[model samples]
Target: MGFFDLKAECAICNKQVGLHRFQIANKEWVCPECFKKCGFTAMTPIKTMTASQVQAALQEKEKSAEALKTFVATKKSDHF
Candidate 1:
Protein backbone atom coordinates (compact mmCIF):
# COMPACT_ATOMS: atom_id res chain seq x y z
CA MET A 1 0.00 0.00 0.00
CA GLY A 2 1.09 3.53 -0.79
CA PHE A 3 1.35 6.35 1.76
CA PHE A 4 -2.02 7.70 0.62
CA ASP A 5 -3.63 4.30 1.10
CA LEU A 6 -3.64 4.69 4.85
CA LYS A 7 -6.01 7.65 4.71
CA ALA A 8 -9.41 7.48 6.42
CA GLU A 9 -12.60 9.25 5.42
CA CYS A 10 -13.52 12.43 7.21
CA ALA A 11 -16.75 12.22 9.21
CA ILE A 12 -18.04 15.54 7.94
CA CYS A 13 -16.85 15.92 4.34
CA ASN A 14 -16.51 12.18 3.67
CA LYS A 15 -13.20 13.00 2.05
CA GLN A 16 -10.06 10.96 2.48
CA VAL A 17 -8.17 12.59 5.34
CA GLY A 18 -4.50 11.66 5.34
CA LEU A 19 -2.13 11.46 8.29
CA HIS A 20 -2.86 15.00 9.39
CA ARG A 21 -6.35 14.31 10.73
CA PHE A 22 -8.20 15.86 13.65
CA GLN A 23 -10.05 13.49 15.94
CA ILE A 24 -13.06 15.11 17.53
CA ALA A 25 -14.68 14.37 20.87
CA ASN A 26 -16.71 11.49 19.50
CA LYS A 27 -13.62 9.83 18.11
CA GLU A 28 -14.54 10.80 14.58
CA TRP A 29 -11.86 12.10 12.25
CA VAL A 30 -12.32 15.29 10.29
CA CYS A 31 -10.47 16.45 7.21
CA PRO A 32 -8.25 19.53 7.20
CA GLU A 33 -10.64 21.41 4.90
CA CYS A 34 -13.67 20.66 7.06
CA PHE A 35 -11.70 21.44 10.21
CA LYS A 36 -10.77 24.81 8.72
CA LYS A 37 -14.47 25.58 8.46
CA CYS A 38 -14.69 25.12 12.24
CA GLY A 39 -12.36 28.11 12.80
CA PHE A 40 -11.45 26.81 16.20
CA THR A 41 -8.16 27.90 17.74
CA ALA A 42 -6.05 26.15 20.33
CA MET A 43 -8.93 25.80 22.77
CA THR A 44 -9.97 22.87 24.95
CA PRO A 45 -13.60 23.09 23.87
CA ILE A 46 -12.59 22.23 20.32
CA LYS A 47 -11.50 18.81 21.52
CA THR A 48 -14.83 18.36 23.27
CA MET A 49 -17.04 19.16 20.32
CA THR A 50 -18.76 16.36 18.43
CA ALA A 51 -19.11 16.13 14.67
CA SER A 52 -22.67 17.47 14.82
CA GLN A 53 -21.62 20.40 16.95
CA VAL A 54 -18.79 21.16 14.56
CA GLN A 55 -21.25 21.10 11.70
CA ALA A 56 -23.51 23.48 13.57
CA ALA A 57 -20.55 25.75 14.26
CA LEU A 58 -19.77 25.78 10.56
CA GLN A 59 -23.33 26.83 9.79
CA GLU A 60 -23.14 29.52 12.42
CA LYS A 61 -19.85 30.69 10.94
CA GLU A 62 -21.47 31.08 7.56
CA LYS A 63 -24.36 33.00 9.05
CA SER A 64 -22.02 35.21 11.02
CA ALA A 65 -19.97 35.93 7.92
CA GLU A 66 -23.13 36.86 6.04
CA ALA A 67 -24.24 39.11 8.90
CA LEU A 68 -20.86 40.81 9.03
CA LYS A 69 -21.24 41.94 5.46
CA THR A 70 -23.75 44.58 6.59
CA PHE A 71 -22.22 45.25 10.01
CA VAL A 72 -21.66 48.93 10.82
CA ALA A 73 -19.36 50.21 13.52
CA THR A 74 -21.32 52.83 15.36
CA LYS A 75 -18.68 53.55 18.00
CA LYS A 76 -14.90 53.62 17.74
CA SER A 77 -12.50 52.68 20.51
CA ASP A 78 -10.69 55.58 22.15
CA HIS A 79 -7.51 53.58 22.79
CA PHE A 80 -5.73 50.91 20.79
Candidate 2:
Protein backbone atom coordinates (compact mmCIF):
# COMPACT_ATOMS: atom_id res chain seq x y z
CA MET A 1 0.00 0.00 0.00
CA GLY A 2 3.13 2.23 0.10
CA PHE A 3 5.16 3.66 -2.78
CA PHE A 4 8.05 1.34 -1.94
CA ASP A 5 5.73 -1.61 -2.26
CA LEU A 6 5.44 -0.95 -5.98
CA LYS A 7 9.19 -0.99 -6.58
CA ALA A 8 10.46 -3.55 -9.06
CA GLU A 9 13.69 -5.52 -9.05
CA CYS A 10 16.22 -4.69 -11.75
CA ALA A 11 16.94 -7.59 -14.06
CA ILE A 12 20.61 -6.72 -14.35
CA CYS A 13 21.57 -5.48 -10.88
CA ASN A 14 18.86 -7.30 -8.94
CA LYS A 15 18.25 -4.11 -6.95
CA GLN A 16 14.93 -2.56 -6.12
CA VAL A 17 14.13 0.07 -8.76
CA GLY A 18 11.94 3.07 -8.14
CA LEU A 19 8.93 4.07 -10.19
CA HIS A 20 11.16 6.03 -12.55
CA ARG A 21 12.56 2.97 -14.27
CA PHE A 22 12.84 1.31 -17.68
CA GLN A 23 11.16 -1.89 -18.77
CA ILE A 24 12.59 -4.32 -21.25
CA ALA A 25 10.76 -6.26 -23.94
CA ASN A 26 10.27 -9.15 -21.58
CA LYS A 27 8.79 -6.82 -18.94
CA GLU A 28 11.79 -6.97 -16.61
CA TRP A 29 12.72 -3.66 -14.98
CA VAL A 30 16.06 -1.89 -15.14
CA CYS A 31 17.47 0.37 -12.44
CA PRO A 32 18.71 3.87 -13.08
CA GLU A 33 22.33 2.95 -12.41
CA CYS A 34 22.29 0.14 -14.93
CA PHE A 35 20.42 2.30 -17.39
CA LYS A 36 23.04 5.03 -17.05
CA LYS A 37 25.80 2.51 -17.67
CA CYS A 38 24.12 1.51 -20.96
CA GLY A 39 24.39 5.12 -22.16
CA PHE A 40 20.79 5.06 -23.38
CA THR A 41 18.86 8.24 -23.90
CA ALA A 42 15.21 9.10 -24.24
CA MET A 43 15.47 8.53 -27.97
CA THR A 44 16.67 4.95 -27.57
CA PRO A 45 14.16 2.23 -28.40
CA ILE A 46 14.81 0.41 -25.14
CA LYS A 47 11.30 -0.87 -24.64
CA THR A 48 11.79 -3.23 -27.55
CA MET A 49 15.01 -4.71 -26.22
CA THR A 50 15.41 -7.89 -24.23
CA ALA A 51 17.50 -8.18 -21.06
CA SER A 52 20.31 -9.89 -22.95
CA GLN A 53 20.28 -7.12 -25.53
CA VAL A 54 20.54 -4.54 -22.79
CA GLN A 55 23.49 -6.36 -21.29
CA ALA A 56 25.13 -6.52 -24.72
CA ALA A 57 24.59 -2.81 -25.16
CA LEU A 58 26.27 -2.15 -21.80
CA GLN A 59 29.27 -4.23 -22.80
CA GLU A 60 29.48 -2.42 -26.12
CA LYS A 61 29.42 0.91 -24.33
CA GLU A 62 32.26 -0.16 -22.05
CA LYS A 63 34.34 -1.21 -25.04
CA SER A 64 33.64 2.09 -26.75
CA ALA A 65 34.66 4.00 -23.63
CA GLU A 66 37.92 2.08 -23.40
CA ALA A 67 38.62 2.70 -27.07
CA LEU A 68 37.95 6.39 -26.69
CA LYS A 69 40.60 6.68 -23.98
CA THR A 70 43.29 5.87 -26.53
CA PHE A 71 41.89 8.05 -29.30
CA VAL A 72 43.74 11.17 -30.41
CA ALA A 73 42.71 13.91 -32.83
CA THR A 74 45.37 14.06 -35.52
CA LYS A 75 43.71 16.92 -37.37
CA LYS A 76 41.13 19.56 -36.58
CA SER A 77 38.75 20.50 -39.38
CA ASP A 78 36.65 23.63 -39.42
CA HIS A 79 33.52 23.91 -41.53
CA PHE A 80 32.11 27.30 -42.38
Candidate 3:
Protein backbone atom coordinates (compact mmCIF):
# COMPACT_ATOMS: atom_id res chain seq x y z
CA MET A 1 0.00 0.00 0.00
CA GLY A 2 1.11 3.58 -0.67
CA PHE A 3 1.79 6.06 2.08
CA PHE A 4 -1.31 7.75 3.43
CA ASP A 5 -1.63 11.43 2.66
CA LEU A 6 -3.27 14.03 4.92
CA LYS A 7 -4.51 17.18 3.25
CA ALA A 8 -5.25 20.29 5.25
CA GLU A 9 -5.74 23.98 4.56
CA CYS A 10 -4.81 26.90 6.73
CA ALA A 11 -7.60 28.66 8.62
CA ILE A 12 -6.53 32.22 7.88
CA CYS A 13 -4.76 31.98 4.51
CA ASN A 14 -6.37 28.73 3.31
CA LYS A 15 -3.13 27.52 1.80
CA GLN A 16 -2.27 23.86 1.57
CA VAL A 17 0.52 23.16 4.04
CA GLY A 18 2.64 20.05 3.95
CA LEU A 19 2.64 17.72 6.93
CA HIS A 20 6.15 18.68 8.02
CA ARG A 21 5.34 22.36 8.46
CA PHE A 22 1.88 21.91 9.93
CA GLN A 23 1.04 22.27 13.61
CA ILE A 24 -2.07 21.30 15.57
CA ALA A 25 -3.64 24.06 17.65
CA ASN A 26 -7.18 24.30 18.97
CA LYS A 27 -7.97 21.06 17.12
CA GLU A 28 -6.87 22.38 13.72
CA TRP A 29 -3.92 22.05 11.46
CA VAL A 30 -2.32 25.50 11.60
CA CYS A 31 -0.27 26.25 8.50
CA PRO A 32 2.75 28.52 8.42
CA GLU A 33 0.94 31.29 6.54
CA CYS A 34 -2.00 31.26 8.91
CA PHE A 35 0.32 31.04 11.89
CA LYS A 36 2.21 34.11 10.73
CA LYS A 37 -1.00 35.98 10.01
CA CYS A 38 -2.29 35.11 13.46
CA GLY A 39 1.00 36.35 15.00
CA PHE A 40 1.88 32.93 16.36
CA THR A 41 5.35 31.51 16.00
CA ALA A 42 6.93 28.41 17.35
CA MET A 43 8.73 29.21 20.58
CA THR A 44 12.41 28.52 20.85
CA PRO A 45 12.68 25.63 23.30
CA ILE A 46 15.14 26.18 26.08
CA LYS A 47 16.01 24.93 29.50
CA THR A 48 13.93 26.16 32.44
CA MET A 49 16.57 28.00 34.47
CA THR A 50 20.33 28.18 34.74
CA ALA A 51 22.17 27.67 38.03
CA SER A 52 23.04 31.33 38.58
CA GLN A 53 19.52 32.53 37.73
CA VAL A 54 17.99 30.03 40.14
CA GLN A 55 20.33 31.13 42.92
CA ALA A 56 19.51 34.79 42.30
CA ALA A 57 15.77 34.08 42.37
CA LEU A 58 16.10 32.17 45.60
CA GLN A 59 18.04 35.08 47.16
CA GLU A 60 15.29 37.52 46.17
CA LYS A 61 12.69 35.23 47.67
CA GLU A 62 14.63 35.10 50.95
CA LYS A 63 14.89 38.88 51.04
CA SER A 64 11.15 39.24 50.52
CA ALA A 65 10.48 36.69 53.28
CA GLU A 66 12.67 38.67 55.72
CA ALA A 67 10.86 41.91 54.87
CA LEU A 68 7.49 40.24 55.41
CA LYS A 69 8.58 38.89 58.79
CA THR A 70 9.73 42.34 59.90
CA PHE A 71 6.43 43.89 58.80
CA VAL A 72 4.41 41.29 60.71
CA ALA A 73 6.45 41.84 63.88
CA THR A 74 5.98 45.63 63.73
CA LYS A 75 2.23 45.31 63.10
CA LYS A 76 1.81 42.92 66.03
CA SER A 77 3.63 45.31 68.40
CA ASP A 78 1.54 48.27 67.19
CA HIS A 79 -1.75 46.58 68.22
CA PHE A 80 -0.44 45.59 71.69
lDDT of each: 0.78, 0.86, 0.46
Let me know the TM-score candidate 3 reaches against the reference structure.
0.34
lDDT of 3 by residue, 25-60 (tens): 333454555444333345611123333433354466
Query: Ten-residue segment with the worst summed lDDT in candidate 3?
Result: 44-53
lDDT for predicted candidate 3 compared with the true structure: 0.46
TM-score per model over all chains = 0.74, 0.79, 0.34
- Could you tell which candidate, 2 or 3, scores higher by lDDT? 2
Q: Higher TM-score: candidate 1 or 2? A: 2
> For candidate 1, lDDT tens digit of each residue in 32-60?
78878878765636667888888898899
lDDT of 2 by residue, 1-80 (tens): 23345778888889987787888887788888999999998888988999999999999999999999999999888985
Model 2 scores a TM of 0.79
Model 3 bad stretches (over 4 Å) = 1-4, 44-80
Comparing candidate 2 with candidate 3, which one achieves the higher TM-score? 2
- lDDT, residue 34, candidate 2: 91
lDDT of the structure predicted as candidate 1: 0.78
